[model samples]
Target: MKIIAYLDAGRIALGVVTSPTHFIAVADVAPDLPTDLIEILEREDGMDRLREATAGRTGDRLLADVTLKPFLHRPNAMWALALNFKSHIAETGLQTNPDFPHLFLRTEASYVGAGEPIFAPPYSVARAFDYEGELGVIIGKPGRDIPVERALEHVAGYTCLNEGSVREYQMHNRQFGLGKNFEASGSYGPWLMTPDEFGDPARHSVLTRINGVVRQRAPLDDMLIDVAHTVSYLSRGYRLRPGDLIAMGTPGALKPQPDDLEGQDLSRQFGPFPTPGLVHMRAGDVVEIEIDGLGVLRNSVITDPAFEGDL
Candidate 1:
């Protein structure tokens, strides 16, 4: 099952996406249910209730006509994996502790919804606005110290995540605080596909594109740390409640498309990159992330005009 939150003539409406272009308002299926996706997931039988109600249903609303909103604009807590994919670790020459997963928090403002523009820090601020496309795991059950064996049971669904990074601020320190949390720098959701629908994470791959050129692509099986372990590891410190989001880390950059620069020329065009062939996102470029069979989250890049010093 696929679910979404969108603007319906200025009001927020929860929906179940029936196809790439259509969705059924949850209000139509069950009027008493909460419009918030997080709120719905918080209920023990929320998904089951909605699932039964919308069974054999088809979407009545056109997806293109509605403005999309972040499915969980304010999740209880949002965590992301860093260097979980060994391929990514090799590309940046970064290391992670062998015993534990490298983790970080992202604020609500750091993400926009699908079809919205992801902000790039102004040129004067930073230019390494890179994209990390990863699988987004949405917690269904609240638990602490969740065992790795039972971790999959706690998941409600999955979504695509573009964990945008401002590399300049990221390298300023090791905390991964500022650079990783820039306002509106990332996005998730075209829609949320439930566990049964999404199937195995390892069977799929994440493919990221800047404009029309593929920049990152790799099979999900390549991750050094998998989803079950990531959830279990995070639960050790805090109880993961329903609506907590976890980005499962992105894979390494692929060979650049023929139209893009190569070698020193690539560096000259996008400034120095820690890894060659890294293409920093620029204003007016459309970024799209696709997790096979899960659907695509697409956003255009725009430099924020806020906090400018008279341009």
Candidate 2:
């Protein structure tokens, strides 16, 4: 079943997307069910209940009529993988670390809903504001030290994610906190699809586009570390809880640099020097990230009004 979170008469509610343009509000079908998407998923028989509630019922309203919200407004944790794709590693000129996957955390505030505007900080036009399209895995059942083979069983569904980045801030330190956590810098979804409908996550394809031009495209299987391994690795330290989100890594550069400058010297040129092929977002550009079965996540780029020029 496909589930969507949206603003119904200015109030947040969950619904089941019956078609491309129609969805039935869960409350209308099952008033007793929780209104929040995360809470519903936390229930033991949440999926079954949703299916039963919307059974034989057509959508109540047109999708365009309601304002869509992020699938999970307050997911417990938002973990992102870095350098999982070999092509991405090559473009960034980073060496492969066979030992483990590089992981980072993004706060809830950093994400906006599909159709929402992606914030471009004051210097965004001058600095690097890049986009990374990735498939997001949502956890339903909580688990710790989960086995790789059994990891898929813990998954509830999947969605699309735009892992937007402020390249300049990211280079300030080894940590990606400030760069990735900029308010409204990234986006989550239009809705969520259950595992049964989505099928094998690896069989899908990811495509990212700026305006009308395609910038990034790659198969889900290109990742050096697959979804199962990522879940198992993360579960080793922390308990994977319901409503947790995992952003599978993105592929090679959507826009790559012309020159192949390696070593520490290249790193120093980030802020002062111009990065070839890295087109930082402007005030009116639209960015779209689409996954095979999952719907397209679209967002327009807008400069942060509060940003008063560069510091």
Candidate 3:
């Protein structure tokens, strides 16, 4: 089941997508079904419930006509991995503990929904604004100390994620820090695809493009730490809850044409970016992250009104 959370006539509703451009309201199918996605997941038979509710039905409404929001109004505990992709680690020349996943937390306020504009940091701040395209794992079943073999049992679905970064602030300290927490810099969604439908995560590729040009492409298997273990690892410390999101770290950026520094400093206290001449996202840029089974998660980059040159 492919689920979407959207706004219709000033009220929030849930829908099941039949195609990239269309969906059927869950309420229209079953008025008594839960309207909240997490509530559905909280039930042990969530997926089964969704299947039975929308059985033999195709979307009658066009998705383009409504407003899409991240399925969660207020996000659940959001965690992300760093240097977890082999290509990313290889390009950055960064090392990590081979046994444990490199983990970090992100605030819910940092994200905007699919099709919404993502704000870039102002020029006065620093110009090294970048994009990290990765996969998102949404937890369905809650658990603690989850074993590796049973890790996937907690997964509800998957979504596309654009983990935007302000490189300058990100490297200012030894941590991801403020650079990652920038409001409206990141994005999630298009829709959540259930596990039974998405099949094997390892078989798909994350393809990212900026203004029609491919900038990042890597197989899901490229991750140094895979999804199941990542879930299992996080469970050792915090209880994984329904709607909790985990972003599998991104792959290395592909060097852009000419590979020439555009005069913006890529240097950090540690070293320069993996792809030094790689172009960074700016206002007016359209970013797209596409995974075959999961629909495209696209956003336009814009400058915050307060940060505009008029100031």
Candidate 4:
């Protein structure tokens, strides 16, 4: 089952996506239920309750008629993996970290919903802005020290995430906090697909396109650390609660390297370089991330208007 969070009559509400463009508001069937998607998922019988609430009801609202919101507005924690895909590491020419998964945190303010604009901060206009298309995992159950074998049981569903980045700030320090947490620089949503319908997350594929041209594509299984490992690793010292989100790392374009640069000053050419074939996003560009079965997450790029500095 697919669940969508959207605005209806000026208030946030939950809907069961009956079709690509149609849904039935859960409130229409269960008026007393909370509108927040996180609250709904926290309930022990959330899925069963949702199914029972919308059972036999024809979708009464058009998806196009309402404004969609991020499936989870404010998750308990938003964690992202860096260099999880072998192809991505190879593209960047970085040594693989074999000991553990590289993780980062993102604030809720950094992400906008699908169909919303991803603002290119004035500082990123030159050559820093970048995009990383990834699969988003939504945690359904709270757990601590979760075993890898039972990790899948804690998953509620999945969604698409565009891990927007600012390369300059990222390279300025060892920590990626400033570069990744820019306001409205990334996005998530459109809807959530339950685990039953999503099947094996690693069996899927992810594709990223900018202005309608493909930039990154790879199968989900390419990750060095898969979803189960990620869940287990993250839960060791931390308690993961329902509504926590994990962004599986993105795949990078494996463009052929130039032979001329083989032995010449490798240090200058290797780190945090602009991804081949992908340039900084300019105003009016549309970026789309498509994951097989999860649906497409599309957003337009716009220059931030609040900045006072010259671009």
All candidates' TM-scores? 0.95, 0.91, 0.93, 0.91
By summed lDDT, the worst window of 10 consecutive residues in model 4 runs over: 262-271
Pairs with backbone N, CA or C atoms under 3 Å apart (clashes), candidate 3:
none
lDDT, model 3, position 189: 92
Q: Candidate 4 lDDT (Cα, whole model)?
A: 0.83
- Which candidate tops lDDT? 1
Report residue 200 deviation for candidate 3 (angstroms): 1.4
Full-model lDDT for every candidate: 0.86, 0.83, 0.85, 0.83
Kindly provide the TM-score of model 3 when superposed on the true structure, using C-alpha atoms: 0.93
Candidate 3 lDDT over 1-311, as tens digits, reads: 88999997888799999876788999898787788888888888876878888878878999999989888655568888999888889878889987898998888878888999999877787677788899999998999999999999999899999988888888888998998889888999988999988987999999898888788889999988899999999899989999999989999877655633442334521225636435688899999999887879999999866678831
Candidate 1 on 1-311: residue-level lDDT in tens?
Answer: 99988898787788998877788889987999988888888888899999988889888889988888888857788899899888888876777986787888999999999999998888778877889999999999999999999999999999999999988788888798898999999999988899999998999999998877787889999988888998899889999988999998988888655656642255444333556556778789999999999999999988886845522
Q: Write the per-residue lDDT of candidate 2 for residues 1-311, one digit (tens) a residue.
A: 88888887888999899988898988888999988878877899977898998988889789898888887868789999988887787777777675676899999988999999998887533366778899999998989999999999989999999998887888778887698888888997877889999999889999988776676889999988888888999999999988999999888744443442321233433442343334456679999999988899999998876685643
Between candidates 2 and 3, which one is better according to TM-score?
A: 3
Q: Model 2: which ten-residue window has the lowest total lDDT?
A: 260-269
Residue 101 lDDT, candidate 2, scale 0-100? 69
**106-183: candidate 4 lDDT, tens digit per residue:** 989889888989988774343567889999999998899999999999999999999998777788788886888888
Instruction: Mark the regions of model 2 whose C-alpha exceeds 4 Å error after superposition.
Output: 124-126, 254-277, 308-311
lDDT of 2: 0.83
